[model samples]
Target: MQIPTAAASGRSRLLTSGVALAALSLLLTLHAVPSAADDDTPARGTASMGSGVLAHEGVHGQPAATDRTTQTEGVDVSSHQGEVAWSTLWNSGVKWAYVKATEGTYYRNPYHAQQYNGAYDVGMIRGAYHFATPDTAGGAAQADYFVDRGGAWSKDGRTLPGVLDIEYNPYGDTCYGMTHSQMVGWIRDFLDRYKARTGRNAVIYTSTNWWQQCTGDYSGFASTTPLWIARYASTVGPLPAGWTFHTMWQYTSTGPVVGDHDKFNGALDRVKALAEG
Candidate 1:
């Protein structure tokens, strides 16, 4: 039998070591890669206003309003509430309503017609709100989706301008994995598109903490967009930069009638004025 040379044995060992090392590197890489399920992107059409807020910020006691003579009462609803009891809510003193219309570019609220028309039928000034999913699609695309779905505004005195519900991300990153400037840009895109399509500046629904964290408290939209601040407290605390006063306030998640409750900054006539605009 021929004896294998030392050099040949050394080369064989080196080759084997190289192969083993390569396999180990591949295995490590495979382990480091995240799966599709790991991405935590929210399912289409599932997000709603205050869904993330309620998850991040727990519920608080409904502060007693010494006098609600000037402020108008309202409610916001989503698919979670199903077919809402509009008459019950109206009887309970809700003068206005905001119904979730679309989420991202995929989910349209199935009960939008019932909730939106139901409120209007009950003599409540009603509006549609789009739950923004900034990560799923471009702002303009999502805005188009919203208007196409049910967020369109009309000259009717009962229909309020569509609302852009841009708040905490319930599925993943709080800012939907966007930087502050990017978030602001996305909002501007949506708002601009909505305005072009409907001839009305859309309302912005967001909490102070979320607006500050996600948009760097950018006040550019303040001059044009109506601010719908969400804060579950006795008082509205501090608002996002730029706005001296909130146009509307979402003050409670567990309202007496149904869904989350809100307050228009002014009286019923003012609510009608906003609807007319």
Candidate 2:
């Protein structure tokens, strides 16, 4: 299948106004992973916008405006294991999943493996892999680790948009001891490599602090990537400044799923739209 045209590959979701593109929508296969509102969140992307239109408004050779990601039902896994049943999770009800594939320099994720593959085997179409990035290693390394070990993706090396887990991990040493700039540099380098190998831009998964502390500057690639923001609170609100919009929002963190004992996830309506439209 030819990749849809999104101008310049991946762009910052902030530019999209964080709303679903009502005009054009499509279905994808994604997995459930862990996500949080912090700095170390990783980000990466890769996809040829067949028409470069986000909401049919920006399809003019320009990337589509995710101002709306069609309202998807998603879940993050790395946080809990043995709770969600792999075989029944998707059937119980889940549209897309952001499964954690890698973290820091090592760590392939013990739970993500089964959960990610399970989502696909069960039939969840909207799928993607997430990386837990640290401000120390940068994005490039994270990208490499993910692409190399994330999972059995298109050998053509492509996914709707690969994820960068950009969240601060105080307990982990993956960040090494690099300065803030050094960390962001690594992320940029990773995004670059990911695009070169996969032929698309990478998405950045970050929170308010991570965006300010590690993801600052580097807007040069904003138009080439998307931002998956994790801002959890009492209720869903607008995205942070600079970011036009978020590709996926982790609104709620706890829920019920047949696969997992007690699961946490987001709404599924949008994801269904992404599949239907």
Candidate 3:
């Protein structure tokens, strides 16, 4: 995989430094993101959805807006969800699942096969995701590692594209110690490599706050990649700079199943189209 060496050569140094310092300071003040290895269940109904104004209609345990927009409800899980009963989840009206496949450059989910395959076996549209660790390795290298593990996709119409979970670092340095431009370059590298290997862009999972503070509100990825906004509120909060709409919304961490509840932004057919890609 090729690494970008001079990603920000054309940008003015003064502007870059100012933005980077401000972003770093802001991230420092933000709370550390919860570790996926630990229970994120309680944070489900907590302020991750933001405080006050609950207006969404609950689907099973998922609460979203009552407005009649067609959506397919689903769930996202890591090993933290533990020994998922896919059939039971499927019977609960879940149409899809995004399973955590890999993290950083080294960790691959040990329960990936059981969770992912079981989801497929139970007739649910399935996808895999990489928990990005931009500080640990070059984006291209990490992307390669991710796809090699479970992030690759098939045009089977039942398999959704891989996802890049780029958000608050559960580790130190919320921005992963990279400037906005640098972070964007690393993400670009990963997306490029993933597309080259799998023939489709990966879905980007992020929160509004993280995108603004860490990525300097970069909007370039909006056009090519699909956004999966994780805002546990009555509505998706202000999205990252470019996205006019979210492709998927993760509404709650505490769901009917052993995972986070999510909704595809459109009808079942649209979700199938995404899977077909």
Candidate 4:
């Protein structure tokens, strides 16, 4: 048997060390890079109310104390909230709620019944909202899907009209790849179809910046459609061009409860009035 020289043994040790270092570097690179599926962006047809708002505007401090005193407290929830604690929320002074019902024509909240009915069971005025995805289907088609699923409205004095959550697109382009005119037309189609199906005007939920960018600040719907302006601030700030006032304001994404906090523009009685309508 031949004996190995010290130089040969040293060379072998260096080569082994080099291989181990390469493996360690590779492992670290893999750990640092995020996979496509690991993206926090919600899947298609699963985007919920304020999904884009939280992504875009981030969470702000609570609304002004004076603002809170005059307006009715509410919340908006999605499947992300799962089965909500409606009773706890009611005890927390939440007077109303909007539960996500559908998204485009592809997705519906599996927990819709629990959240929607649960809120009502707790003596809170509850309504459903549809997360609009114009790129997936026509506005009218999505509206039909919404109403069929859970967005339907009746003047039962405990339910408010459904809302069209039209804001920053979680999937792709900010305006869902449509021109300003096209975006406006698509929204009009959704609102008109929803009204035709439910005999009530669907509330339009959007941020001022998103409305300005996507719809060219169109004022055509201001007269008929109720606006639910999203602004995570102490005040609502400037509204979209034609809306002199917002019916509801989503004030904060990080509320103490299960979902985003909102405020009706008036007292608790006004909220009941909106429900009656």
Instruction: Mark the 10 consecutive residues where model 4 has the least summed lDDT.
Output: 60-69
TM-score ranking from best candidate downward: 4, 1, 3, 2
Candidate 1, residues 53-95: lDDT per residue as tens digits?
7777677538437534468889999999999999999999999
Q: Please list the C-alpha lDDT of all candidates, in the order they appear.
A: 0.90, 0.50, 0.82, 0.91
List pairs with backbone clashes in candidate 1: none
> What are the RMSDs of all candidates, in order?
6.1, 26.6, 18.2, 5.0
User: Model 3: clashing residue pairs?
Assistant: 49-232, 56-64, 57-64
TM-score of 2: 0.59
Q: In angstroms, how far off is 52's CA in candidate 4?
A: 1.0
Question: What's the residue-level lDDT of 17 in candidate 2?
Answer: 38
Ranking by lDDT: 4, 1, 3, 2
Candidate 1 residue runs with Cα over 4 Å from true position = 1-42, 64-69
TM-score for all models, in order of appearance: 0.84, 0.59, 0.78, 0.86
Task: Report residue 245 deviation for candidate 3 (angstroms).
Answer: 0.7
Candidate 1's clash total is 0
Number of the predicted model whose lDDT against the real structure is largest: 4
Candidate 3 ranges beyond 4 A from true positions: 1-62
Instruction: Give the alpha carbon lDDT tens digit for every residue of 1-277 in model 2.
Output: 8674576344545346334552223222233343564435333221111101121112112112232334545565653453346555556556566666666566666665566667666666534554554543556666677788763245321123566655554344423355756766776787787887676666666555544555454455456666665544433345445566555655434335521111122344444433332
Residue 144 of model 4, lDDT score: 99
